[model samples]
Target: MAEFEAERRMPAEAEQVFAIVGDLDRLSEWMPTPIGVRQTGDGEVHADVDSRDVHADGLVGVRPEQLRLEWGSEDSPDYAGWLQVEHAEPGHSSVVMHLSFLGDQPEARRHGSAAGEVRQWLDDALAQLERVVAGTS
Candidate 1:
């Protein structure tokens, strides 16, 4: 799998950041596109996501203790990722996003050949997340 990690520091409390990121339905507010999330089970287990322009029918795992969310392609498990928030500096928190995708896919195929795009998208998503957190702060 081709993978990359991106980090962003936000001026918000760790628990607050976790609240925002931990809510699966709020992903679209920061992500590039709307994420349609449905509870697949317990808050600590899985959630189903339908990001029409991105991953469709993806399964996400939530680890609240670590403030992390993990996801993988439901169809083939070819795409996967991790999103986390950690306490940082004094009052601020840091967010880290790790994403991986199976290589050698056609451009026509979304996840196969878009590593760079995915990285950039995550960067933007983090920035937007900061703004959202700041507004609520």
Candidate 2:
């Protein structure tokens, strides 16, 4: 398995940040990709993502301060990932995201490209969130 992680500090309060990440349906508004998410059951979601080069069915898992997903295209092995929120201070929060693809996919693990992609995705997503929260977007 491979791993990618990124962190962003938001001016918004922890509760507010948590509220945003907790609702799966709001992902399209702040996530980097134009993705639509739907909850299928407990700890499960389906993502209709349009921005990435590949398309896949995503399974979601959620906790009070964390969200996770497992995804794979029809012909490829699955990838798994999670987003976590941590309260850093009053009216401040941090987001951490981690992603990993199956071990056998050489392309997925080579040159840390997968990790870089995920980091960039999270960076953009958080910037958007900051804009929205700060009433600048």
lDDT of 2 by residue, 16-125 (tens): 77677676676667877654656565545566655554445555555653433334343444566667777788777777776666667533563666456556776888
TM-score of 1: 0.77
Score residue 113 of candidate 2 by CA lDDT: 61
**Residue by residue across 1-137, what tens digits does model 1's lDDT show?**
56777899988888899898888767666775433345445442233334324444566777889888888766656767899899988889999998776754432234543545666667878888988999998
> Cα lDDT of all candidates, in order?
0.71, 0.63
Which ten-residue region of model 2 has the weakest summed lDDT? Answer: 65-74
RMSD of each candidate? 4.1, 3.9
TM-score of 2: 0.71
- Winner by lDDT: 1
